[model samples]
Target chain A: MPIDEALLERMLLRESVSEFLYREADLLDERRYTEWLDMLAEDYQYSVPLRMNVAFGETDAREETRAGREICWFDEGKETMSLRVDQLNTGLHWAEEPVSRISHLVTNIRLDAVELPEVAVSCRFLVYRNRVADETDFLVGRRKDRLRQVGDSWHVVRRELLLDQSVLLAKNLSIFV
Target chain B: MTTVEEPTRTGAPQVRNLVDVKNGEISREIFIDEQIFKNELENLFPRAWLFVGHATQVPEPGDFFSSWMGADPVLLTRDDKGELNVLLNSCRHRGMRVCRYDEGNTLQFTCPYHAWSYSIDGSLVDTPGALHGVPQQKAAYGTNLEREKWGLVRAAQVHNYKGLVFANWDPEAPSFDEYVGDFHWWLDNLADAFDGTEGGTEAFRGVHKWRIRSNWKFVSENFLGDTYHGASTHASVEAVGIGPGGKGKRRHGERQNEGGFSKGRMKTSFRRGHGASDNLAYEIPYPEFEEAELDEYFVAAWEKRKEKLQAEGRLLGGRGPATLFPNMSFAAGFPRTILVAHPISPTETEVWRWYLVDKSAPEKVRDWLRHYYMRYAGPAGMTEQDDMENWDYATEASRGVVARRYPYNYQQGLGQETASDLDGSVHSHHAIAGEVNARAFYRRWAEFVDNLSWPELTELARVDDRATERDAVVTDVAEGVKVLDAVDVVDGPPAQ
Candidate 1:
């Protein structure tokens, strides 16, 4: 009976995490940037490292540019993210001024670790952005996250994304993934 | 009478007709037409001195960084003798790309297809990228294949100007020094550290490269004295300030009391198409940071640089958002960096950005700059993201037949140029708004695309009648903008 209860606990926790990620995606897609910002803890760190093309065996060492050390696409804490949100609201950030229609689909969710109060997660993201007349981009990537429990909800403390691209295909990364 | 020419169509008149400097009009065909794109790749790129990867990228012997010179892929390598080399990446055999990896360390690049090899190792070949081995040499060709002359094609000339490597495919074009001229002042600010050490900077390990659907010229024009766009195009970023001074400050983080952004910033337009947004006279100090350590570090650097440069009798300005004609562009202040807009087609370009930092910077300063540079430029930067939107949409909308008929205007500050102390260059004292740089750039572009002989190009630029004519009528600046007539705005910096 105890073993069965433990398995059920794991299942419930996975569902909760999945629901939190899905709700986060909904907020982003709905352009409720302020609400989405609330989902992040004050100490939240987000990074999107540049992917490199290296020889087969050298990938483990050189494939992804380091987050805090090397030059990456987006590397900063909540303050920078808040500024990015401010830029979006200005109605003059031409890249997102007209408001890009974005669909952030988070799937393949896996609970990597759970030390209580904090949980590590892994997920795949397929973000589709279309704007203006015909500009379209599909950014597919693997993402890792560290979430902290807050009573009934969860707050993202850290996120690291590894886009499966050597050279970014999109013209601008104006939307949050 | 500018009209679009379909690719392969003949007798379309000279490219000079498409670029009318007198009227300050440039036809849209050059940016959207396929044939003109081919002409640019074939004629202009080969002759122009282009910025390749830096020497630090390949510091160790056998290290390589795959780069692009215009449209051609090149392997920037360091040979066994510890010399840098720029070789065509295509294999000598089946023309396969010899190195597909973005960067690595390898003495020889063996063709993945046929296994034919070329070596930069001293024991294997006389020169770097020389053909070292051929699979089945005697079995397949029976001593008929001459490996001596079958090596990967090498760049005709490669010059490492203070660690910023540049290459040209035309051996007769001009020496890098001759080509750069007094524009080296801008290059000096870019390549050197903030403390005025000669070539004391190196590129960061990661490069931010992304594809944008825009003609390459759009990228070049924006940086080449297009200060006019900053207000309207970057209003959002300005409102949200991502500068060293942190939020609510100007994005450039310029000192608080500097008369509103454009006060003394003048446009320096060179006869050879190289251009800078700020002049040597405009010497605005570097930005102020909110963090005290950052302020201390930069202020100390400023003092050191002032002492060193003044002692050397060099003007302490000309830190530019400048373009080194034909495509390389860079900015030296507020997050120093290099950008190369490689032509993919008429309407698509691959933009590569490399950030620079002083080699001697402390860990804190280095980290702060690295973070600042990431947020300030490139496709992902708040300031640059909007630029891509404009560039892409401009290229897309201009493809309509009705839109191509209306030529873009480059008439701002038309025919208003003052002489400079630097040779073969002029200054547009509009301070804030001037298209003189773009006009000069387009004129030089036409000459290169038309494949004018090196002598003709040199002679045309040596004593440019247009600049001279402006000099003659310098006082006739129509808009009543202060035009410093017959003034050497750059004063006189000791030539290197």
Candidate 2:
């Protein structure tokens, strides 16, 4: 069967996709967590797997360093994430008691495949976070996300974050990357 | 300028001056003095059994993990024949670190500075173009430049308890068994075989590491006995209805009974300053936010492991924080954990934390435990943030000119130590507030700083558990206050 390039391009290559991702990053940077939660689907999953310093030549590195098998920074569902946000609002999340100032620089947005209402998107992100004076942390990573269309907007259904450092040097991962 | 005498200076504090036993005072110099920190590296670290990494981290041949023993970088490797080796990570040539990565599997590690390569067993296998690069390598280096003589420097002793790997630099230091002493019974509660598996506990995949601007001893002594700070330090967590406070709210509030009469709670000081704050028959209450089935799975797993625990007499009705002498600490709560601190300087430390779970438990149970560990104790954990804030401030406060003159008080429950049913342990009946364990720790520190012989240290560690013979003093500053004061206590009442 011949592929429908026109429909695929219309769903994935639309400018609205990149704009939506930019808006999401802005929401996080501004600490507008409650508003950002609206961008996630009802059954969304967010996870960041532990990166391993596997030897350069090892072929099974990907398999050995994936989610579920090894320890992770986060492997949260929507409900768990919601609880975290609610806790943050209580002003008792000591890691965030003073609130960290973050700049989420999201770039290199690319839409790979489109399947009806679902689209696969990937982007690079660099988050600079500062807590009070003399404390700062920078995180660089790539996120693979699956976004589902809800009315005129796209809701994040799944996200897998791959970080650059194996052993995090930062004091804490309290702020979102 | 007016003449002013320095409070005291002889590089390190004299053993007698460091701690005032009867007064229960600890000198601020030990925590902030630069020369004392350097002395510790030479006098204490080498003589202590420092934890490196777990055996499972490098289960197969050629696997390795880069770790540190105080300021010295070391590598933990499993050889082709399956023997574990702890080798200095620095190359014998030019002092370059041979392995740069945190962990990996490699048959040979090649130094980036000079292409000096070492085999998994830490033998200097090859040097790139050694014959051509410098004929002086044979002349200046002498005729006896043999590869066999240039092998990596290994720890004088390497041993594993359960799966936790430990190494020592001094050949004359006591064996791991002698060093651990009576804590064997308490340690088994956190380790030992699982219900359905042949192997005992195993650390989960990755280690959680972070830097803290505080002295390592602050962390070690806190976990060793400072249970009094829990309710107040972590009050925010309780208010937010999360973490240990939320799940075990009943136990958290009711555990403290004013004059320190908390049932099933006691402090056990083992030989060589190792000590633990224990609670008998501790319960793990599931939080309402978690899945309901998590409790059921945990109960099922606990039932299977309880039989072995009871048979060996290692099962405790309650569990709490414990310290293994110098720097290692154990949290024998749900999702068993070990926290190790590596001193970077007098006021800086790097902390490494590992979560140990029974391999035989259901996969779901293990997952839940892993989640609990990350959520409660690590750098990003809710509970850990509260403790770190206090420790950081404590370290900064010790640097004051006048403040350093006055010693920090460790007098609570000082004269209340009681004889224990467990042999070779100094037991304190008070659970929530007590300085008995900290006093024991500082006493050992003074012996080490004084450069006492192993025999002398062993003899010093031996004393009547029923009284304060080891804690007696003959100093002018000794203020003999026996009973614990109300202002010194903060923990709430015990659970129903």
Candidate 3:
């Protein structure tokens, strides 16, 4: 099928993709990180590029940069992402210690395009993180993802996050978006 | 004892009495006193070489970044002429901050209050009514009102040392070079690539800023010498494979004392409150690469530069952290990170951190370094969260009147650093083990806080070569070395 026709078809499946996203958010909020990892395809590329506060005329809305031109807050492959889970498994990574109470609110589901095995989806997210006694952070951003169908389940193949705040308001982003 | 009096009006304690480096004693009041905080803002911060953003941050003309010099909001900008200036963000008319955004490119800043606009170079360009005499200023003061004096206040001095921009508020203060003294050589190592290539070091985009409920001094002083807290504070770093304690692949955090992979350690202190503590032979702990060829390129470059660096004494070992007195500090090794601690109040500090790498390096190299920086030491990095916890509690505990009465003991390496061949530098043989640099830091800090004139402060900054010598053996070479080196040395530890 032509790319445009395929995208139109994917747009028809937006309901299913939104359901998949909500399910993913539920997994993350429950601290089911390993199970969350299971939702990823083998060739997953997860990244949270840095956002900056620049003049409107300077660039796009997020004022982000190309991959090599600037750096990101979180840019990890499947191995690196797995390593993060491994670090958490040690039960010592103090950043995650005391265990964060997170509520991942995913909304504004929009279908962008689709290829043979993957469907591109866009959405808005607000990850409310509360830790220990008083520390709390609200990370709101837009995420673009490529979800691939593996049997009956959707696996995240690629994801890019563009946060609204230039300087991260949270201490550490130990939780995935 | 030669006592340094505080400003008589504020009733602050005598500086000499406030800190006793010889006895390793420091009054907790210095960390929690409101009057002393006010004094520091007036006397110390204005005179110090406070770190601003890097020159590369505003590479294009009209580009700007807003930052704080102490508590004052300032705008760092590159004008149309490509000249750099630090302007007070407050408008002269209503004291409204003219620039509200964090960073941007603008030919001129217009005050939102009354539409008064000033050029990027801080020249008052338009007054909205100056030509037509239609509104506020002209109607109130007539034609005699001077517009020149109403321009945005600019920093007294602005200069870039190897692309690191710094600003001072006091015109009578010593030059940046004079203020930093010999610490410039140490700073150069962090900002420059091994080849000394032009435009080599550039801070990666986006800064990590976090507020800590602690005195700014605690953070800067930590970078100076207090590696003692590492073992307990960062015990988790090892439990994870990222640190040296584990027997895994060990890509980074080379475990300074686990197997004795180093030769020795040294700490250097200079005049004007600048000091650094580092390993004798520290290398970048982790260098992750996608291609083996890129890895080979880095190793080859390092091998070729090692001898030259050794000759210059810059290649002394695994790098550690250093502070340029008052507020600015740098992790003087791999994936070099620079930090500025802006004192917001007596018990609150806002810290700004940036990681720099070789600009000429490959994309993957820069990417790898940034990833390590964010994961390991950035605001949310593994190591930094541990430090924030400590600082937060320390500040909270010291708020009590009883706690403020006691002195924080800094006697770890008191009377220990001896004469060294490094030219006016002294080293504690135990390397990461002692509090040598911290003592010197507080001493110089006391000197800066003294009610002395500019000339007197300059005179006092001169180091006495004979004063640092001690007839004592180094302690904790075994324990201290391991605890300190277990974390980031290349990019100063996350203590700040």
Which candidate has the highest DockQ of all?
Answer: 1
User: How many angstroms is the interface RMSD of candidate 2?
Assistant: 2.5
lDDT of 3 by residue, B304-339 (tens): 566667676664343457788878887755447888
* Top candidate by lDDT: 1
Of candidates 3 and 2, the better by DockQ: 2
User: Which rank order by DockQ, best down to worst?
Assistant: 1, 2, 3
**Which regions of candidate 3 are displaced past 4 Å?**
A1-19, A59-62, A65-68, A110-116, B1-16, B121-141, B242-262, B279-291, B303-318, B422-425, B465-496
On DockQ, the stronger of 1 and 3 is 1
Docking class of 2: acceptable
Candidate 2: TM-score of chain A is 0.89
lDDT of 2 by residue, B1-496 (tens): 0112243454444545677766788778788888778877877887889989888889998888889998899999887778888888887778888887778887777777866667774232332111122234655677666765566678889997777899999898889988887676556656654342334778788777778888999889878867777666665555554432334343222223322233335566764788777633333332232455665655565576676556766543334478888998877554478889889999989888888887665788677677667666676665676677667768888888877887888898767676554445666646566678888888787778666778887777666443545553311101211222322333453210
Where is model 1 more than 4 Å wrong at Cα?
A: A1-3, B4-13, B259-261, B470-496
- For candidate 3, lDDT tens digit of each residue in A46-163? 7777666665676675377444445567666686677677767777666677788999999888878867478888989998988777778898989999999877668999899888
| lDDT (Cα atoms) of all candidates against the true structure | 0.85, 0.69, 0.70
Q: What is the alpha-carbon lDDT of model 3 when measured against the actual structure?
A: 0.70
Q: Which stretches of candidate 2 lie over 4 Å from their true place?
A: A1-15, A59-64, B1-16, B121-143, B194-199, B240-264, B279-297, B312-319, B400-406, B464-496
DockQ of 3: 0.35
lDDT of 1 at B288: 79
* DockQ list for all candidates: 0.89, 0.38, 0.35
